[model samples]
Target chain A: MKIAVDAAGGDFQPENPVKGAIQAVNENAHISVCLVGPEAPVRKELEGLDYPEDRLTVHDAPEIIGMDESPAQAVKTKTRSSIVVGLGMHQKGMVNGFVSAGNTGALMAASAFILGRLDGIIRPTIATFFPTIKGQGLMIDAGANLEVKPEMLFQFGIMGKIFASDIMGIETPRVGLLNVGEEKEKGSETLKKAHQLLEALPSFVGNIEGRDILAGNADVFVCDGITGNILLKFGESIPEALQTLLFAAMKKNQIDGEQKKLVGGLLKEAFAPFDYQAVGGVPFLGVNGISMVGHGGSSPEAIKNMIVNAARMAEIDINKKIITSIA
Target chain B: MKIAVDAAGGDFQPENPVKGAIQAVNENAHISVCLVGPEAPVRKELEGLDYPEDRLTVHDAPEIIGMDESPAQAVKTKTRSSIVVGLGMHQKGMVNGFVSAGNTGALMAASAFILGRLDGIIRPTIATFFPTIKGQGLMIDAGANLEVKPEMLFQFGIMGKIFASDIMGIETPRVGLLNVGEEKEKGSETLKKAHQLLEALPSFVGNIEGRDILAGNADVFVCDGITGNILLKFGESIPEALQTLLFAAMKKNQIDGEQKKLVGGLLKEAFAPFDYQAVGGVPFLGVNGISMVGHGGSSPEAIKNMIVNAARMAEIDINKKIITSIA
Candidate 1:
């Protein structure tokens, strides 16, 4: 199967995507990659790279989307953009899936516009993998739809369960509704309604508190994109801040010089585990096509891993299984 | 000055409160404590404590509210409960402030009903102290008013600012409207309206993302309790989870035992500077009487610190200052 990578996406742009695509193509024998972006910068970054020509091809789309630009405006104006072109390839069945680290809004809009929502799926949810002590937990609706109903949350639980079982290989993954407290009556009207609906669900673990998300309380933690997004950012940003502080303290000799280095290194390392890049891209489920959106700060290694992850989703027929389960 | 202490409140009740009240009497020259709870158990726990009798009086309120009891029902049923008696003392002007580690809901309701909302304040907010790197931050409405409008948020901001400056001793404390992103246009309609309203206020620091809460990005972080409750619990829970995991790993020798211990100790120390014990009780701003709620996890030291904090609040006439400043 062929996968399309948006080379014009992300903060590092052509270099990370180009290097990562080449690496992914080299490693995965059954998968081929079509890098979509401007040929000049992509090729320059690809210089001296030893990649399988048959498996690695470039599909140039000169236009790019800016971070600040409105997603709706970009989709309307930048018809030949890399994201749009990549979505086109998936629509035509030229590629099995598409990946981008670009504007999240644009990716969601373009993917939904091109491939449409899967059967029985009203709106797609962003599924991010949160690394926990019990293994990686599937944190669904990380930043897809802001305002969601109880029905949507129930759907998120179903989709998250499938993602965990099929992709992460967790059998009967425990589903937990991320709430302020564990009690069903603890949350807002939306949460209370969702909790009642989730109780009837198979493999439901009841309401898990915010603390439980990182504590590895459940294999699958589900919430609306708004709260999920807030939690995701809080988890990501805190560790980043801690690591930075640890480094600064060590550099300034604010802590015990020799002891601080050792302690600081370990603290930093512990904090590093929570970083977004280490977990790769969050897959946008419920769409007809398999598409992933990596963080803007992701490195080549992370992008390469995301490519592999997306390929595995295609290989395991995740989209088909999700569609079947939801239906 | 007279202060009422709920001797039977908290996870480690009677012992902590008894020892704490004794400690407060010993430490404060002019302070008198009225320990409210069941007489026999409180006396049994206070057996070893040595303090002046005139300063330490027990106002027996035999009934106690369990942590799991419904807040509204508990308040309605347990009329002569320790928490209620303590709140009543505040209302009667017999005590300058009331301290409790009892049911949060019961405390909020009792305080609101007994003390009544200050003029222009609709609902009483539970302002909690947040442990931040650059000192502690105040996040009010931590879970008081779940569904909050821009008007309520504006009041929260004003009260939070007043508490920060008058109580925490931070001048011109920066106030932030918690949102998904830093952009002004980001977040829901309430947030946008709140953002605009907050901007017009003198101390408003614009929109702050969830990640910034722990980084000490602003002196006061404001949000609706639904979101605030989640964020506050999220912050408190993550560190607790990390500590648990770290200790578990250390116990199994899965990591460098000595090094891990040392780092843990340092983090415990660095984080100690902002521990709840040091911050004492969260002042119930916009209320007639000075009221603070200690955490159930608070130790004897925490209780003593809270008494001192409450005394300081009384000394500075925080309530009068806030009323005038907002007016």
Candidate 2:
């Protein structure tokens, strides 16, 4: 399988992606990578990297889509940008999937516009992995569509269930509607309607509250992008705030350096799941082909994980399963 | 000053409320408490408590409202219930305010029905204090009204601003609309419209994301009850989950008992603000009279803090200020 990496994307530019692509190709003999970016800079960064030349190659695309540029406009105008060019390769079946650690909006726009939605899909959604006590769970529509109808939310549940069962390896993944209360009568009109529609699915688990997200009560949780994005960002901030507060308390308590280091190490181990770099990236599910987007501040390891995960997703033919399930 | 305590409310019932009331009267020489519950149980619980006899008295309320009962129906039928009778005292001007640790929905229902709303107020909102890096910030509409109009959200901002200024003591609290993004064009139609309405206020800050809640970017944040309640409950569960995870890690690492105790103490102190017992209860803003509601599992200390907070709110005439501000 071959995956295209957007070398010009992300805050770190060509270096992280180039190194990550080299690492990915070295780790997986069955997989090959195409580094998509400006030719000279991409080659310069890959010069000293040790890897099989046949597994790693460069695809030059001169234009760049900036991190802050309007997503739809950039995808429309910057046709030669790495994101556009890379996704174009996936659209033409040149690569099995495409991965970018760039602007989320731009990547989502380019993927939807170029690759289009899967057969029988209403709208393609973004699915992010949320680390939970029972391992990790998936939340769909994590900022793809801010305003979604009941039917769209139901589709997200189905798509999320497929991803969880296929990639995350959760058997009969419990799909839940993210609501304020556990009771069926609770939540807004939209959620109430969505709850009813979700009952038709075999894996549907009534309604799950916000606390249930991290508690691992459900394998798949679905919501509109507005609520999902807020929940995702809020969950991400907890570990950071806790670390600062714990460090300040330790300092005030006059803890010795050795003990402080021990405490810090323990905290890092305990909070590994909350780290964005560790989780890597979220996939744009329901698209025609495999498309993954990572954090803009992703490190080489994170980018490599995204590439490996994208390739795995492609190998499993997740889109084909989703189409069959929806049909 | 006088405050009515719902002695039959909360998980620990008459015990927590009765002890909290006695503590409140003893702590404040000028303040008096009316314990509202079944005459026998309330008097039994209050007996032997060293408090000024004249300052703490029991008001007989025979009926009780269960936590799981339908809120509006319970309030309407259970007229002699502690929540109903306690709120009735405020309605009749018999007490300056009412405090309960019972069912949140029932408390909200009784407060709205008996206390009524401030002039020009369309609905009452629940405002909870969230611990932030800067200090503590307030979030409004924390589950009072699930489905809210844009105008209601605008009102929440106004009411939250008043509470932050009068109670939290921020001179000019920055009121922000809780949204998906910092950009003005982002968020749902209701939030976008609410943003425009909030701009007329002097201290209105633009859109704030969920991460900003704990980061303390704004003194006051407003959102629909559905989102605010989810955020509040989700935030409440973090400390518990973190403790469980950290303890397991410590056990696996074979940390000694002494170090475990020391780490436990430090974590307790660091997470003190996240403890609902420390923060006491949230206030029902926009009501004609002061109404404070504690968590169902509230300790005696939490109930005491709620009583004190209610007294302080009544002393400042927060409702009167809200009336004038809105008009």
Candidate 3:
């Protein structure tokens, strides 16, 4: 399977993507990567790196899309941008899938516009993986759609189920609507209606609350993008907040220098499990074909894993499964 | 100020509330306490306690309200319950305010039904105190309204400002509408419209994301009840989750038992500052009278704090300020 990588994407640009693409081809035997960017610049990043010469190729495209640009405006204006060109290659069936650590809005916009959504799909969404005690769980509409209709929320559950089952290997993946309370009557009119719609699925576990997310109560948690995004951001801020609070405690207790270091080391070790980049790329579910996006600050290893995961999705034909399931 | 305490409220019941009432009267000079519950049980709790003869008294209330009972049904059926009696006394001007650590929903229902909402108030909401690096930031509609209109959100901001200014002692409290992004155009149509509505306030700081919550970005974080409730529960779950994750890390790192205890002690010390109960009680703002609710698992100290806070609210005539400001 040939997967295109947006070389001009992410905060680090062509160097990280180039080094990562080389790592992907080196690590995975059967997959070839197409680096999409300006020819000379991308090739310059490829210099002195030991890569499979035949498998690693550069697809020249001159323009670049920024992280902060407006999604629709940028996609329309930056036609020759790496994101557009890479997705263009995948749209024409020249590549099986595309991956990027670019502007999430731009990636989603360009993917939906270029490759289009699958049949029976209302709107494609970004489903992010959240680490849980029981393993990884998927939260749909992480930041894609700010507001969603009941029908759309129900569809997100269906898509989440398929993605979790086929991609994450959870058998009979359970989907839960995120609500204020577990009772069916709780939350806004939209959430209550969405709860009813989600009940049609046998895997629906009624409604789950915020605390249930960390407990791994459900394999998939579906909600509007606003809730998911806020929670995601809030969860990210916990470690720093804890560290600050902990330091204040240490100072108050007069633990001094040596004991502080030991305690700090232990705290760091405990928080080590929350490495978001290790998950590689999170696929934009309900799209016509495989497309994924990593965190903007993702490292080279994360990019390599994204390439491998994209290839696996192509091999597994997860998109076809989603289409069949939804139909 | 004479503030009634529901002696039958909270998990600890007559013992904690009765003891707490004595503590409140003892701690605050000019304030008196009236314990509301079954006269026999409440008197038994106060038998050995030393309290000012003229400052502390008990009002007979035979019925009891359970935490899990339906709010409307409980309020309707349990007429002689401490919650009902205490609120009834407040409504009749026998007491300046009522405080409870019982079912939050039932308290809100009874408070709204008996004491009524302040005139011109769109809806009465519970604004809970959140501890931040700078100080406590109030989040309105914590769980009072499941769904809120743009008008209600704007009103929450106003009520929150008055409470923060009059009670919390902030000179010019800032209010921020919680959204997925800080941009004016970001989030759902409801949020965007709410953003426009909030612009009328000189203290409105555009929109704040979830990350801004702990950093005390605004004195009051305004949102629908669902968002606030979810975030509150999520925050409460962090310490335990961190402990679980930390223990796992400790086991993996092969720390000895002595070292484990030391690390655990330091961790606890760090989390020591997150005493939600210390804030006493959160007032149900926009109500016609002073009514506050503490955590269900409140200790005697928490109960005492609640009573003191209720008395302070009565003294400050917070309700009058809310009415004046909203008008």
lDDT values of the candidates? 0.81, 0.89, 0.87
Ranking by TM-score: 2, 3, 1
Q: Which portions of model 2 show Cα errors greater than 4 Å?
A: none
Give per-residue lDDT, candidate 2, residue A307. Answer: 92
Please give, for residues A225-255, the per-residue lDDT of candidate 3 as tens digits. Answer: 9888888777767777788877887787787
Q: What is the alpha-carbon RMSD of candidate 1 to the true structure?
A: 2.6
**DockQ of each model against the real complex?**
0.46, 0.71, 0.68
Docking class of 2: medium
CA deviation > 4 Å runs, candidate 1? A244-258, B44-48, B244-261, B315-317, B320-327
Per-candidate iRMSD: 2.8, 1.2, 1.4
DockQ order, best first, reads: 2, 3, 1
Considering every candidate listed, which one attains the maximal DockQ?
2
Off by over 4 Å in 3: A256-258
- Report lDDT (Cα) of residue B135, candidate 2: 80
| Position A161, candidate 2: lDDT | 94
- True-structure lDDT of candidate 1: 0.81
**TM-score of each prediction:** 0.93, 0.98, 0.97
lDDT of 2 by residue, B218-267 (tens): 98979888888878888887887888778878988999688999889888
Q: What is model 3's DockQ versus the real complex? A: 0.68
